[model samples]
Target chain A: MSVTAPLGFRAAGVAAGIKSGGARDLALVVNDGPARAAAGVFTANRVKAAPVLWSQQVLAGGRLRAVVLNSGGANACTGPEGFQDTHATAEKAAGLLDDSAGEIAVCSTGLIGERLPMDVLLSGVETAAGQLSRDGGLAAADAIRTTDTVSKISFKRGSGYMVGGMAKGAGMLAPALATMLCVITTDAELSSEQLDAVLRAATSRTFDRLDTDGCMSTNDTVLLLASGAAGVVPDLAEFEQRVTEVCADLARQLLVDAEGASKAIAIEVVGAASEDDAVKVGRSVARSNLLKCAIHGEDPNWGRVLAAVGTTDAVFEPDRLNVAINGIWICRGGAVGDDRSKVDMRPRDVTITVDLSAGPHTATVHTTDLTADYVHENSAYSS
Target chain B: MSVTAPLGFRAAGVAAGIKSGGARDLALVVNDGPARAAAGVFTANRVKAAPVLWSQQVLAGGRLRAVVLNSGGANACTGPEGFQDTHATAEKAAGLLDDSAGEIAVCSTGLIGERLPMDVLLSGVETAAGQLSRDGGLAAADAIRTTDTVSKISFKRGSGYMVGGMAKGAGMLAPALATMLCVITTDAELSSEQLDAVLRAATSRTFDRLDTDGCMSTNDTVLLLASGAAGVVPDLAEFEQRVTEVCADLARQLLVDAEGASKAIAIEVVGAASEDDAVKVGRSVARSNLLKCAIHGEDPNWGRVLAAVGTTDAVFEPDRLNVAINGIWICRGGAVGDDRSKVDMRPRDVTITVDLSAGPHTATVHTTDLTADYVHENSAYSS
Candidate 1:
């Protein structure tokens, strides 16, 4: 159930003084392979972190041997100096692993705008490299946590190859990929093109659908590395399925652990004018603070849902919209329909379905309800 | 300091059992008039409240004798019955006065999806007409409030005329007019076209820039009535200036009294490519929940500001952006610039200045920080 669950992968986590709280803040994952194929999906935010910039350039060759990640400083908005720090971190990792510096990828998380503690980070990377093992995925996942209460790890067993992944995120989660750092490993004989296609598809359906807070981060990065150690060239479709399953599992974990969230909601928008419209209406409902607040209080206030739907450009009449929560038609034809008291929201999982009554396209977005704990956790103190 | 400050306005407030809480939930304002030229702006929300729909139809003839507003029910998405309720309220107000129902406007605010109690609403309108007096503006303002801690009232004195207004709103505020109801009265003679132009301009600069919680309401309405009671012909420019001043004053009061807000933040975006771009950038920063949370915690977390700016299409170099908090330049050229600890945030008034360095256009938006109180007030068992 971890990244190292896949064959031909070695991983480790190490503590560095970089985190003043005295926790593990550095991780190393190496592909000890006969095949080195890699693909990556970085943050959509224009103001990206130094590591994101470095990794995007490094992946231009479609080859990667190792990855080094840290969770102390995001190394974002730190100017040219921040870029130099990221470059140095990659060079240090390459030196310890007998690999080319250009073939190494780097990821960073934690507070933005501060320079990383270079000395402590390099020492931790050296220690992590020495401790790397086939069963070190759990430790590597632990090292990447920021405010998350638990590390995320997922694995999907297949006919021949296996898919494994790890992720860490608790805030600034929204579109185009959540505020997250994830690394996936697979022991399948797939080309770089195959890896890229599956990675993008898997992430678009998983990471890009988590909108816990409607915030886009500057340091989101997801990487997929393939090493053909299973000695079987699996069907591309089968491999994509397994990769998507692993990502789906990781996304659910991230949503469940979203900071201060009490209810994990799945919003489905059907009968829209287009796929984009469906997603737009769904996101509008998912991000409504009033609706989220009502859900947190367990109030089946479907009026807020209709109000949110009205804010979008989706094709639907004010009198034709319909809404259901937990299979109860609380609103139909944009007015009161069924008994709202019959709907139950006592559980952590909630489903809200909106019928746009326009076309047949549909989309789903996973979100969490707003709670006082959300404000308390986010506004308590500075990192 | 209220609607009565103007020369020709008579107002009243009466108890309406429509609100189960037994608050003063009904109000009436009459133009004791010689001149009846009027103009109004209603909510941009596609799913508008019944009162918004009724008021738009009533103001189409460029005349209005009185306005009747009620709290306790938004009468939004409540189907055709809600429209009938609004029509009945207008008819009841006109029956008590020597005026036509077509010359009466109506507005309602409170929880959405519920139908207004027609019996209570009509009775309150009749009683309000009987109690109308020049000193009743304060009571009328008090009657419109739902969760507002204080009634919002403002008066702008001119050389020969005065503009006075009253507003009620504590939540569901955003641009294109906030979740607010405002009635402005003046004694100057003006055409309906002139009134429409000036009211639009005033609202565009004032009420449209207050985005407390980024949720647009279904019942936002602003009305302007001129009675020519001062027996003086005021200059159009002078009257417009007074109208803008009154709206600005009311906007400030609304921000200060925003539900559960801990601080009032003024966000100014300068050096944008256009006025629209400046406003767009400023609003993006104002609506960022992460930045609001940091402000509530009193931390100068400028990185969050940069993250929000990146989400927009505003023209600016990623490394050339700058930000200031209070009087300290905390971020310069997209990097750390000031001693963050030197900037104090103990005051309730906080100013965030962003320098886009793209062009010469600028705009400002007023907002509030997210607090645990905001979440508690919004999610506490639903109003």
Candidate 2:
């Protein structure tokens, strides 16, 4: 179960014939709630998708009753016509549900600069709204995949409440939500302001830390809707914890299921002057093609680590840095240390630890290795 | 006649046992000059190589008589002993020419975190000094090869003066010199300050714009040696133009000879508010892994271009952006324009032009496609 895992919520997925193969490509999630509170975070890209623009405006009202998402057209760079299409889709869903169009959010993901086939999409929306059920979470999850190899769904059970989210993204990932589509459903009795704070804090620590390919998207979005069916008004800390856990789980899933990834690498930077510096340094190392290539080759090449670190303005002395790959200290005090040949790299999970020896702060970024398969997948066609 | 194409310069390339199989790994270039005014730019990497450190100090005096380069080992991250080795190498070269060690600049390229063989290097310097000749430029160029398939040498004859240079770099390329070693010889009558200004200006427009990859090197160095043998005091603008043309030619060669690259991409960002924004936007697009993959697959993915631009803070309305692959405007006003099929990619050279439509500024960056061979080479061995 995804969104429907929470009380007072219903979900459904249906085929819209938007994808070339007639795959399931449209989804709907509804909050049949006594209390409607919603918050969202959209891509910071100056060029946002039409649906992202619509959803942002809807979420601004601090209340949402439904979310409609399509997988075969991003509706981005389609100009004002695209915006009208998004508005029409939301209004149609609202009319079918006997609700306000201002309370319906929308998201679209697929090829950019293409207008959605509104005829099929509107008809699919009517069908999906009819198919909405409490157990439709998995189906809804399947409807949002683009280049994703698998559907990403995660849920966390809090005391008398729960948080559930489903995410879809393959590549073009980085900080600031990592080019993903996500919808969160919660049955916790909380105000929209509380939900907004919790979502921002949770996302910053979770989805924003995975710098997959350093490419930000124009349609990245995450929506959280609360139904208050469980009647659990938990404290802010507990609520934030549950939300963060679910988001982190989905973030990990995104990394593990990254398109064409051969190995999942965790780059942890320690002993930084501040958390931001640590993240900056970690991101710098994680984004280096040379370092990622070395990781894919399973070569304990620590020199590239130093080279990447040197590019950052973070506080660190060149001679005071240390790097360890898979628990073997291959570089210490900025020079070669342990025997690289002894370091085993046959596993798919790789850990690179960099100690700046500057301060006590630390941060970690999750990433994947650059491989020939990745090149093949991204280069095989335009996606 | 590359580095020695200019008057009052002698160069040599000699076999050094530092590299396996006795390949020529050491080189020497001497300024048999009336004036030894020289200027250089080293890598901005905080983790400086031993040779880079030595050369920086030598250039601090605003004069240089000779430069000794080794290709098989980069004495970086080797600690105090590495610095001592660089000192010894420069001291030996100075002794061979009866000049002060402060007048000898040094450069090294190859595996980092390894010490150079002092005995072999010292002997190789002696042999290279004895082999120095005015016609040894080609041999000198050949000695600097690491992963490069060809020797890059360019010369420009000016009014009563001439400038010649050689360059070598395979990858770990980005702004701030883009990780390369270059020795420029000029017979123009100019002071060290003039050389500094001209070199910075020329490199800013040439080598700095060749961001092959986002990895900056710890051993990048570009040295300009003026022998002033032609006794020609040309105008400043004329001298700068010649130097820029030579550097630009050599930069293009570097891109053409980039390791494992099947295509060279020239990214031009126009209508930016400032030159900095133009370069920044161009670099962001050039470094996108997804975009690079699309290019390697012969996909003219202008959507990826907009996504990359959205990541930067460059001033532009999303709806006003346009992109062209080759001469085909596939995207106009951030919407689909011409058929993407109209663009052709069956060539070694590709150009991606982005019009931000914010102001009247522009910049161009040279890069290469991300290939499977690139991943294989960077990952297969610990370089």
Best by lDDT: 2
Candidate 2 docking: what grade? medium
Residues B83-152, candidate 2, lDDT per residue (tens digit)? 9999999999999999999999999998888889999999999999999999999999989878777889
RMSD of 1: 2.3
| DockQ score of the complex predicted as candidate 1 | 0.56
**Residue-level lDDT tens digits of model 1 in B276-367:** 98999888888888788889989888999999898898899989999999989999988899989989999999999999999999999999
- Model 1: residues >4 Å from true position, as ranges? A171-178, B171-178, B231-233, B381-383
A-chain TM-score in candidate 1? 0.96
DockQ of 2: 0.65
- Which ranges in model 2 have alpha carbons more than 4 Å from their true place? A171-179, B171-179
What are the lDDT scores of the predictions, listed in order? 0.87, 0.89
Per-model TM-score, in order, reads 0.96, 0.98
Error of 1 at B195 (Å): 1.8
